[model samples]
Target: MKFGLSLLFIIGFVAIHLLSRRMKFVRMVPRSRFLSIVGGISVAYVFLHLLPELGEYQEHLYGDIGNAFWSFLEHHIYLISMLGLAFFYGLEKIVKHSKRKNSKKTKSSTGIFWLHIGSFTIYNSIIGYLMIREEFSGAWGMFFFFVAMGVHFITNDKGLWEIHKEDYEKYGRWLLAVSIIAGWGIGAISEVNELIISFLVAFISGGIILNVMKEELPEERESSFTAFFIGLFTYSILLLLL
Candidate 1:
């Protein structure tokens, strides 16, 4: 089931990017509101589902580890979460600065654009890899996971397009698309320590929170309260009911 679903997700991920950026109808959709809804759903998943699961994974971390390190590990996932957020925040700043310096040119420097691609390749890869590591309790679990991530990837790709324009089209987008497949292959074949998986998840959650807000919350972006509220409550209700 997972093998089939993961393959579907990889294809869907690429298709969404194309539709969101290239299709006129999709481009006509209110992006701010759409992304806000996505942000809300992603946050719901983090708060309602992922965080609780992290607590369970924390328990599994105990074995022969000393008390101090165990204690540190317990408390430090949150800190690692903060680090993930900060890392992306700083990277975005650097990429933007690099882009600005080359704004007069047709494309940014290859070095600058590669930096952007490299960071987001890692980001997209994490989503693909997590498709395998995430334990979905039922069909709905997988559904929400796909929905949130599919929307999240669309939002992230839109942000990249805004920043890089043709440069992203020429170089970054295909690299990111390929990274998703690569990460899925790696996740399928390789097994990591569960504790490490937990940490990576926590970190990714933090990154998601930061990235979603960066795109959705800006004053320049006009957001639809109706759509945003619908997204929040609908996902919240699903989490509670299911």
Candidate 2:
């Protein structure tokens, strides 16, 4: 059952990514926004928790929003990505402080944009980390995290594209560099594992984040040590799970 379910999940996504990205599924989503993205993550959280028992394929968190949201996030990130795009579109409507041009043009939203982002990360990260810790099970769950993470990446690609199309136009990519460094640095706030997996998680997380912020911003590379540090840590965790 475990093996079959894993295969089923993989095949299903293959069909969806290839046939459905351009399909009515994408079009039919009603709200198509970020809170909706949060809603998707919530569903994913529940699904993942249920998956292991279904397939006898136990797995834990994939460093997704941490624990609170991790259970299903790897499954739902695509929705989250789409929802994020929708959320931004909606924000364009309700935010009175939004820089609307008197005639047509608008100004770069430097202040509140960061404000929104800051709040989002803090609220999500705490919940997510607890979920990861909560998913403390044996190693069989490795397939659950790795495969889900792979699928999650594709969704991230969607989120990245949508966010770039809509928001980065104003912010300029400088924030990409700053935010990545900040996320990695802060996620590594623990001096305990500062040189270990924790820091790398922070760094790669920073990278995954900046990936969305990319193309619009100048390409920036982390130092070889930092890059390796982050990759090593990520792979290490993957191996641990597997």
Candidate 3:
């Protein structure tokens, strides 16, 4: 049953990527407004669902929490969360650094292009892996996860395309699309401990928060408050009802 459901999602995931790349609707929407809505929905998921879910798992993973190893492990999860955010931010910094260092000598930096592709490949793989592992109770839960993540993946694809342009078109998107399937395959076959799964989810929560904010909060982006609030409230309500 799990495999069947996952296969459906994998198909959906691939279709979404293809559509987001080619669809005029995605391009027609104001970039900032669309991103604002997506980002707001992402934030709602993190705060309303993801973090609370992680908290529920904490007791199971940490046990009494008085033991040194338990304490250390708990700390490690939080640290990993922060590290996920920092890692992505550092990747951006590195790309910018490369761009600056090579700007005068060349119009395009090959090093920066590859770096961007490599980083996003890992990011997409992580997202795809997590998709297979996401625990949901029923059709509604699965649907919710699918919608939230489908939109999130579109945002990530656009972000990469904007940054890498020709490189993303030539190499990045296809690799990323394949990585999603690969991740799902790996996740289906793998048996990870619950504690490890908890930590991975926590880390992803942080990365999602950071990535959404990076898109929505930039001054130049000019995000739409109304659109953002609508997405926030709508998803928040669904989560509450669920």
TM-scores for every predicted model = 0.89, 0.29, 0.87
For each candidate, C-alpha RMSD in Å?
Answer: 2.4, 16.2, 2.8
TM-score of structure candidate 3: 0.87
Find the 10 residues in a row with the least total lDDT in model 3. Answer: 23-32
* Per-residue lDDT over 1-242 for candidate 2, one digit per residue giving the tens place of the 0 to 100 score: 53344344334433433332343333212323322232233224223432233222212224434456444643443344344445544543433345453223343244545654443344233222222322334435534443334333344334322333335333422333233334334433433321222322332333333332331122231123333334444444544444
Candidate 3 runs further than 4 Å off: 27-32, 64-71, 102-108
Q: Which ranges in model 1 have alpha carbons more than 4 Å from their true place?
A: 25-32, 63-71, 105-108
Task: Please write out the lDDT profile of model 3 over residues 55-127, one tens digit for every residue.
Answer: 7777676654667765776645667677878877887788768767776643237777787777766666666
Q: Arrange candidates, best TM-score first.
A: 1, 3, 2
lDDT of 1 by residue, 1-242 (tens): 88787778778887876666774433413465666777788878877887777777777775524677656876556676788889888987887788789878765567867787798898888888888767887667777888888888877877777777787887677888888888888889997768778887878887888887776666567666666668878998998888
Q: Give the C-alpha miss distance for residue 198 in model 1, angstroms.
A: 0.9
Give the C-alpha lDDT of model 2: 0.35
Superior candidate under lDDT, 1 versus 3:
1
